[model samples]
Target: MKFHMLHRVYLLAGVSYFATAPDVLADPVSLLATAIQGFLLSSTAIAATATGAIATIAANAIVIGGLAAVSLLGGRRGGAIKPSDAKSTFEAADSSVIEGIGRVRVGGMKAFGNTDGSTRWRLVARLQGPIDAIEAYYVGGREVVVDPDGSVTSPPWPKRSGGSWMKIEDKLGTGSETAWSALVTAFPSLWTSAHRVRGIAQSLVTYYNPGLTSGTYLKLYQAGVPDTEWLARASKIYDPRTGLTAWSDNGILACAHVLRRDPAFGFDGFDWDLIAASANKADVLVATKTGTEKRSRVSGMWAWESERGATMQQLMDSAGVVLRMTDAGKIWFDLIDDVPTSEIDFDPIDIVEYSWKSGPEAVERPNICRLEYYSPERNYDMAEIDLSGIAWARVQDEIDRYGPKYLDIKLPFCPSASQAQRIARRMFALSRADSGVMRTNMVGLAAWGRYYGQITEPDTGDIELVSLAAPEIDDEAGLVDIPFAIWPTLSAWNPAVDEADAPDEVPELGYTSDIPQPNAPTAMVQVVYPDTSREFRIGFSLTGTYDLSEANYRTYTGALPNGWTAMTEGTNFAYVAGDLEGVTVDCRVRIFNGEDGSPFSEILNGIVAIDNTAPTMPVASSGGIDAGTLNVSVHGTSLNMVAIRMRKRIYNDILGWGDWFDVVTYAGRPMQDLNFSDSAASQEVQWLLQCLTSNGTEGPGLVYHYTPPAP
Candidate 1:
């Protein structure tokens, strides 16, 4: 519910891209194939550009929006994608599934799987969606090319009529999904016209039950798949210019797609035509890559499972794309390149009311930017490049003047270091320019600009490029307030020209600033040394943030007012023994940047701190059956984590165990949400059973790795 305020210049409440989101293991190129995580901010707001037909309510209202610093770069944070479960059919139905973007290979969770007597079985697995198409499907970890007739074509299967083989079917998961023909034919009572899995990309396999032996007799069904993998071209984007939906890693197209599908934004419709035009414009403004063929200035893979606004912001910021709504309540997309013309050139004296900020405060603006990216060659792990010393960027002189610390930029989708370097340079350049924001409330509506325009400074009279502008309506005041942000030029970002920048005279201070010391350490806390060890005595870690300047860090601790002495030191981050000799009550940390040291920052005000680790493995198994209902329990003990939720399912001898189901949630005494759904069983039914987490996401191993004592 809280919003992140970027320094003093602007504050983001609802619907801000620079907003802070939840701790999640977001996708890194190949997505959930790896548990790599990154952070995005959170907030509750109306749709970004598609506020739909309703722009204003009744009387007095605030249309929350405007251009703010896109908080793109920072250190990676915590999170988890939905765990890949082999028995997903038995999983909770309400749990939000992982939806993907770009090219990805992820496991599927079954929504439903059933059988017809002893001969046939059907498994419907829903992968993250609404996806574009499946490029390949794997069974038993091997690729199988499925023919259109639903027969196994490439892997070669018996063309037997008595259900001796398997056939595969796929649905792109649109809003309107037709029920499977085979399922409807075999189980007409259960799979009727109403049995549609809409908005979920699903793959269904109709084959001879894998469980049957030559006479694979006794077993009724097999719940376990040898292995299932789906590799596909995820989320196709619609190009307004081309009027076509195709496979593209275009960040703008990606943003457009998610916004359209995610109804949480509360928009009746969108201006797709406008978005398409802007995307076309963005494509021409290229950032050069050494050995790659890239057509757009910004394009990258994204597999985010977070807040809708925050996700959209990632696509927009990564490509320098901007979204704005005009006073007429129409949405417009603007690319941050060169401005060819002004919608309305404004001079301060003519405006009714105005607030002009030249840019961010001196201390807040960054002189150097360090871009971290996922490299394909590095197996999608993170890598970094610096954006200083480039002639077109902030340069060494600027660094000497302002570079006390470097900004952390993450391009989770940019796979090339060279491309990352180019984007990082532009970001640093944009940050350094006088990013003036003009908040003027004018009486006449026509005075406002539709897109990028020009603003004449009150004192200097110099023209600037308007980067963004969002118009606000104040019906009571009878005035339209449009706040616009601008750069100090009329030229677009040119990679070729900027790459050739090499200043003749360099400052003696070079890249190092003259500041006496570095900033105090940040994200300082205690941690468990060997993760999952549960040994709290090993760590009081310091995540020393100023990587560009600091050489190392020093820690001192002592009881309340007693004397403080050096405890230890670390180059970038440090983890030291807790419950140690001198460590007590107060923990003080300072950074030494080779030249000088920073002021000590006090942390852990007596209360000991420990880093958040994975939830403990399910331990202490206990199960019993009462009145035909099976009850089983497992517990994991850890100081850093708490069990956020719990679920239960029933075990099947043949089909294995079904997915875990959550307790019904409603509202009661205080009328709170998430109250239990059902109090008792409706009829002679499926018995209840309980289970838990999978690999990597919850533990170093299977969290609920348990078999209840034989009943």
Candidate 2:
């Protein structure tokens, strides 16, 4: 149902009754639908979107074995991360590096360690550099503010037995670090001038305790306690455009560093000039909540160790970037942006044959993306975030009609909340708009420079946008079978300005231990039936003792929202009455006490009360000869409009094209008649006829061959 509706993989390792839960006594189908929203369920779900998903079997189900979170499509070292792979922080065991751009918190290797056996102890940490700068320090898993001179400010240091304090000496080394002269002076043989440690961010920590007993001194000195951890900005990378290195968190700059730095992980000894030029023009593109900011910039971070490809993917996912690999093995990347990057403007003649395919059903699609990630703001520990202000997404009436749906995902290497939110927003945008696949078969040179995945449908009169594809070729048949995902172009959405702050995750929405149902916010929904479409309007209408002003309603569509929006600072939520166009279906109001749902007032015009079935494929006429022209007839239950298009072919060569035209049907006709004229000079044509309801839903199309009689 849509008045106009509005709309990630999240990693929810132990997703405890996540998202919306329907009442236990509810119908089994409703219960299953609610369960499908929060978890990355198996393929078989409650219902399919295109068809009525009574029990749908999905094609894409997420795998979150461990990692309270890790990004989508999994990482490179063969497959996804498993439970056995979960461990303590990588800072303790791995040597960290910052590639591309962005700021990150890193732990370092102890290059030097010395203890005087009584009063003093010294240790040196070495970091990969020359880096941009050390921004902050995370000592004991907490970010601590520091002065320019390396003195801790916020958490005042605690003293030892002899009034001695810990202190740090930092060398913000851009390959110009000097030796520890004082350590050399105190113990010449142990610490020397050769320990300059140039080209690395170096830190020397000292602990001195003058008056301690033997046992106390040994315990304090031998303990594995560490000093301040370093959070530094990554150094500039080579921009093929500038012929120099510069500071940037740009996707191309990041991906380039991954590909050219070291022989072990880099794709060195190859020509990247073409890739670099593509980057110069395309790297700046980024995902936008507005769907208008084509040159929107994105950012990412890397502080953990992983396979080389995984690192590259994190950068791409963080920036909502699209990396296209060609059959020729050439690598190209672009942002999940609104801008059209394709070279050729398409014409219908390019499509020799085409068929429409439905994307994941609403049951399979998750509206809320519970994205888990590590945050630099939280001292490099795990954090979760989502997006709510994104426009033109699946924030439609479904969330209010069904229940909350969730797609739990993780960005293992992503550290910024804003970056994580961008990726989550992209998931929602693409899932809502790019769900259908157009299986287009063509035999032409029109797609010479265009990627197989970047093509759009040729017919302009359809209700779709630029189509997405996963490429396959029928080499023997001499056809490129490009199954295209119907992707709505951003510019077409004309997305409204969304300035609301994307709601941040607030300590698991206050649910801890055994979940107690919230004793408030029983909601009501008005199911409006217009001529063709169903519009559902919902809001919490202050019942019981729960104050309407203080209550925050987190409505679930089928999944969790990309981000959660609560009653922050008295935010005004828009409301609609339970009746539209003065028609009401007698039913029970929806109950959302916890994150669970109740039954809807089920009513269908001219159908059973509990029906949610879709009209099947329509039967169309084979273009029989009548009145000196070809006659076409389309049949369906709730018959709508007939979309007809034709093209001519002769001698095994396809010729000119005909744009799609819709024949709107009127009620009370036993059968509808479609008339075609000769304004465009119809010849022997391949006629494509499809059905579109007034609400703009489509069914499988029918094809026929027709020839016009001479006038």
Candidate no. 2 TM-score: 0.48
Candidate 2, residues 355-409: lDDT per residue as tens digits?
6655556666566656665554444545654345444334556677666677666
Superpose all Cα atoms of candidate 2 onto the true structure and report the RMSD in Å to 1 decimal: 35.0
Every candidate's lDDT: 0.44, 0.41
Q: Determine which window of 10 residues in candidate 2 has minimal summed lDDT.
A: 1-10
TM for every model, in the order presented, reads 0.46, 0.48
**Best candidate (score: TM-score):** 2
Top-scoring candidate (lDDT): 1
> Model 1 has how many clashing residue pairs?
25
For residue 562, model 2's alpha carbon misses the true position, in angstroms, by 36
Candidate 2 lDDT for residue 412: 54
